[model samples]
Target: MKVILVNPPIYDFSAYDVWIKPLGLLYLSNILKTHNIEVVFLDCLDRSYFETLVVKPDGTGKLPSTIVDKPNILKDIPLKYKRYGINKEIIKNFFLENNDADYLIISCSMTYWYLGIREILDIAKETLKQTKILLGGIYPTLVPKHAYLTFTNKVDYIFVSSNFSELFAYIGLDAKNLNFTNFPAPDYSHYKNLYYIVTRFSYGCHYNCSYCACRKIFPKYTAKTVEQFVNEVYTLYNQTKCKNFVFYDDELLNFTTTKQLFYEFLKLNLPIKFFTPNGLNPRFINKEIAKLMYELNFTDPRLSLEFTSDFTHDITDKKITFKEFEIAVENLINAGYKPHQISVYLLAGLPYETLNDVFHSLELLSKYYVRIRLCELSPVPKTQLYYQLGLDDTVDPLLHNNSIFIFNGVPGKVKPWCSYEELQLLKKFVKDYNESLKQKTIHSYAHY
Candidate 1:
């Protein structure tokens, strides 16, 4: 059997390279390959696309994009609507040339980026009239109802997870005798041209924050053993010669896992750089772990400090407490990391959170480190926050875009902590703080 895997493009006002990869699809690709099925990969967001634009000093760059008409639901928004990928003409040509596929599996990412899936599906249906297509990933897993409404009549099947037993049954494969005693790792051989790769050693978060939908989608908290991680990395580096690896774990620093992973990484002694893009829970950091991180060449120590004080933070769940956050800063500094070398993630534009709350959090963190990464709250389906706000699947997914929260909340329906003008002031404050830090001292830390 021959199959095709596709990573759809994204449509938004702004997008960035978070060292993103279709990890879920890669695992599924591995399963098909092990069954002796021919697999073809077409990654819309692949970094090596020749037409990619806005290349940056960092390995990450932008995809080739074109401005398009805004979705009917989002027409009034002032921001320009753009599609970040090859144009429809090029996409159609691709479909025409690569029409020899029996099954096509399309993967999705954020719920807000669902338009990309709709666009790709249109072309795939027209060019490959007899091909059967399936949809799976974050968008579908989190909001299956919406996925059904949009794609029920278009696609052959919609899978909530990678349960190949059901998927094989649909494809008429008698895999009843095939034993999945051990699943395979993500297949990245097709993406060998990437400069930086994303690696996830863990599956889900053990801690359930009310605002997060991780546990709902993942169902269980599973992790690969230390040996498994080391073996994957060793092979990846040798195959792609790509040294930059960003960990995409939702909770890599919970309990002793981060420290254990560090020891295993050190044993490899390979000339590679590691990073944790999903900010680490500061509560897990200690002198021992910090020292090991520096020795092992882990750059970009991002601390997850959602709010400044206990009162302002979500009290229902557990993460980095304010006290633990301070301890982590102290440990990182004493371990020889410079002030500018460390960064903190602060959440802004919460539904009821005030500018004062954000300012207070920023003040507590600014003294310790000069850089802060601000994240806007984008309520998603299946999260407590969404149900708390009475958000339904009927709502347009584009409203969940983080950038939209900067201007207004839910198209002027829900009230944010601060107004648009207030947000501008906050942005200015951050820019000034970062500028002053640059003038004061240069934190020359080796990254890479």
Candidate 2:
């Protein structure tokens, strides 16, 4: 049977590619190839399709988009919402040309982009009406109810598994023995054109922050062996001559794993640049790790300091301390990294958080001479906040959108302490603060 795998577009206020690839869908394509099933990969968000791409040298790029009408619920955001990706004609033309697929699988990410998913599903209904459609990935897993609400009538199934599970079995493969060793390396050769490569050295995360959905998506923390990592890196570089790589792991700069991975990295020393787009934990950075990162050509290292002070200890679950952040920044500086070479992520727009709190945090962070990234909270489903407020993704996926959520707070419980104008000012302050500090800036790298 012929299978078509799709990576849908993003409908948001702003979207940029920080080495974001449909890694799962790519892996699934190879798995289908291994099983001798004919696979057709379609990416609605293809960056290379447009003539003028905002792609940087490090594999990150800005998505091509058109300003879309704002959702009724999100009209007060004061920013233009967008449908970021290739145009509708491109999606329709692809399906129109190749409408013979037996099964169509779509991968979902960012719960708030549910509308994008629906748009693609609607296209599938119009063109590939005879074929079955399956939805999987973050959105379907975290917000199954919402997924069903939006897609139940248009699509045939919602996949909530971390693994292929019944998907492989349904495709007539022996699912019981499927593992990574036997799995084919993700096939990106089919992309419209070349960009940089993205790989994962680890899966899941060790810490379970109140704001994170890592535990639900990836229950266990798993790291690749040195040999596995080195071999994969060499294989990709040799095949594609792509030196830019973004590590997709939730956590990789930890003490124990860094020691092991660095030794192998030093030996291989493939002529490649590395990026830690998935914000590194400040507490994990030490002198040795910092030195190794610099030597290994790690660029755009961002420290994840969710909150500036212990005031949000209950909300952040005390992941890291201010003292720890200070040490990490110091270590990076001491290890030959300029203050501007690193960036720190601080959370803003949380429930019950005052603009005064963010201002004070900014004051303290600015003293360090490092770039500051103000992460507007996009309260995800299945996290502590979601449960605390009794919200599922079904409440209207648009509500989960950070672009809108940044302006409005939870419907009834509490509104953001800052007004829409105040929020804009805070965001502007962050942009200006980072602009003011020019410590060997290595381009902006966002983790999510």
- As a TM-score, model 2 comes out at 0.93
Which residues of candidate 2, in runs, are more than 4 Å off? 180-183, 439-448
Residue-level lDDT tens digits of model 2 in 95-152: 8777988899999778888888888888888899678888889988888887777788
lDDT of each: 0.77, 0.80
**How high is each candidate's TM-score?**
0.92, 0.93
In candidate 2, list every pair of residues with a backbone clash: none
Best by TM-score: 2
lDDT of 1 at 280: 85
